[model samples]
Target: MSFNIALSGLNAAQKDLDVTSNNIANVNTVGFKESRAEFVDVYAASLLASGKTKVGDGVLTADVAQQFSQGSIQFTNNALDLAVTGNGFFATVPELGSLETSYTRAGQFKLNADNFVVNSQGGHLLGFPVNPDGSSASVSLSTAEPIRIPTASGAPTKTSEVDVRMNLPAGDSYIAGAPGNFDPDDPLTFNNSTSVTIFDSLGDSHVMTYFFVKDDPNTNPNEWMLFAAVDGKPINLVDDSTVPPSATGIIGGNVSGPLQPTGGVGGARLTFNASGDFISQIPTLADGGIITEDFTNHLPNGADILQRVQIDFNLDPTGPNPNEPTQFASNFEVTALNQDGLAVGRLTGIDIGTDGLVRATYSNGTSQPLSRIAMVNFANEQGLTQIGNTGWKESIVSGEALAGEAGSGTFGTINSSALEQSNVNLTTELIDLISAQRNFQANSRALEVDNQLNQTILQIR
Candidate 1:
């Protein structure tokens, strides 16, 4: 009996030492939790035996409980290294379509060959689908899916309209400086000229130049001719509302076709009142500004010939305060000039918010919301069964896993570019090691004393 009791004590002490050593060994492991060995004393006696002098049997190992306390965070340069702040775990799967999952605090993640976010062991990180407005589509665990970043996004859009706002030099000041005629090559024929970049269906850019020429004061008062050129080639304007859709424009009520560089052909007309205020337009300014610049015969590239660009000059008396073009006495200046178009874009960068929402930016000045990281928590964290790789699986002892977005409700916020260090404390484990060693020594001495007493008894007999 003494031998059995001493043997049990030695076993219990060895168990304690093993637990302490494991804790010390994994001190630097990320997301590692320390464990403790618990023991209970055993005793057995018949009901009839004297209760006052009862002795204990021995010590028995009860449980090896793991400590799940929060660990300190270590920041890194990688944005995918995530850490849970208060409560929650990062859900991961072995592959892309596998429903079987493992929960972990180790968030060292990177992109695979296919651009799917995966961990060091190739476990895919799960996330929730996001709406166009950057909100999670669903918070249920059933809807969580692997996160994948698009390598490229966004499509090109052609230029349809250009808002042009400028102050045309008053009266003859512009005409006086250069009085010959409207010649783009000479720069003296037109009073003022401005150029804007426009995009085609294929995202090809071309220069659209607008030349403003003061009309002959003798033919029409307070009138100016508007001529346009695309890619340095003169383009014709037309009013489809006319009887036969007469040529491009009407100068002083006369229709002309292709505008000539000598200032004698087709050119849109702008009429202003004696007070230097815009009042009317020739060939009529359509409901939404005039549209007549046609690329039917002048596009250099293989762009669609039917595509036409409209120059919007709100020639209205009551148009929004700052939208209409003014013929002020100031120097020729383009106050506002913008085109509605977009070129094909390339992926630029990605940003992850504290709420685990991912957004990607493009080179075309556009941003798109990708997905929201899924956060999961268990009712009984200690009841989860360890599955290695610093991950755990839901067991019967642990309740069902609950999924939610980070920073929502009681869920902990995710820290990107950081990792959670091991929770084991070296100081405490070293002390435990020393104590367990002393216990082992004491148990060994007891076993030796019991053996000596038995030997002495045998010799005396």
Candidate 2:
């Protein structure tokens, strides 16, 4: 009986030593949790046995429980390295199409050849589908899917309109040849010129230049002629025969006849007030607007039909508006230029927000949500079974996983570009190791004493 008791004590001490050694070994491991060996003393007691002097039988290992304390976070250069600050685990699937789920705190992830996010073990990280606005589409665990990032966006779209707000110098002199001699190639033909690149239906770029030539200062002191051309090809606004030039050979000199309209064979005219404030636009379109222009055969190979672009002067004759262009005496400058067109862009980088939404950025300065990482919390973390690779499996003792978005409810915020280090404390493990070694030594001495007593009794007999 003494030998059995000593042997049981030895076994229990060995188990304790094993747990401590494991904790010390994984001290530097990422997402590693320390474990403790729990023991219970055994005693032989029955209904018929007297309780006055019942001797203990031995010691037995009850459970080897894992500690789920928070681990220190180490920041890394990799964006995919993630760390949780509170209670939650990163759910992953061992196989691509498997329904079985495994929970892990190890967030060292990378994109595979297929662009799917996976861990070192090739386990696919599960995440909730996200809407275009980066919001979670659903919160159920069953709806979670593997996150796959797109390498590029779809085809490009042609630019239909360009909104520009700029100030044209109010004190500039008129062109050398007036309106009839206005040419894009000659700098003296136009006072100020601005160019913008526009994309066609085939995603080809074309330079559209706008020439601002001051009108005859003697007759129209506050008027300016606007000429537009694509690749130096003048856009014909109207037939020159209908509205002939004035006696002075200038288009804006006459205020009557077919040339009465500000825009005819010449470019659109901009009229300003004496105080350098924009007053009105001439050559109004059929819709009573002077801000739009229609250009035919704009592309080199007729890649697209008529290219209609709206030149937004940003003038709102209504109340107070700061975006409107003013005729300030300052040098000609373009304040803002924007166009609604896109080109084929390659994937540049990825960003993971605090809400666990993974957004991929493209070279075209556009970002789209790829997926939202799913965070899961178990009712009983200790009840989870270890499945190696620092991962855990839900057992009967551990209730169903509660799925939710990161930073929502009790779930913790995700720290991107970081990794959660092992929770094991080296100092504490070393102390526990010493205690277990002492216990083993004491148990071995007891066994030696028992063997000596049995040998002495046999020799005396």
Error of 2 at 25 (Å): 2.2
Worst lDDT window (10 residues) for model 1? 243-252
Off by over 4 Å in 1: 41-54, 171-186, 215-227, 234-295, 298-320, 323-325, 456-460
True-structure lDDT of candidate 2 = 0.80
Clashing pairs in 2: none
The TM-score of predicted model 1 comes to 0.81
Tell me the whole-model lDDT of each prediction, alpha carbons only: 0.80, 0.80
Q: Which regions in candidate 2 have their CA more than 4 angstroms from the true location?
A: 153-157, 217-221, 236-266, 282-296, 300-307
TM-scores of all candidate predictions against the true structure: 0.81, 0.87
Question: What does candidate 2's lDDT look like per residue over 1-461, in tens digits?
Answer: 99999999999999999999999999998999999999999987999998888889999999999999999999999999999989999999977889999999999999999989999999999999988888899999999999987865645567776776778898787765577677678787678888888777766777877778788988888888777777776554332333332122233434342233233334667777787776666554332233223444456666555455656665556533566566788999988777777665578899998889999887766778889999999999999999999999999898899999999999999999999999998998999999999999999999999999999999994
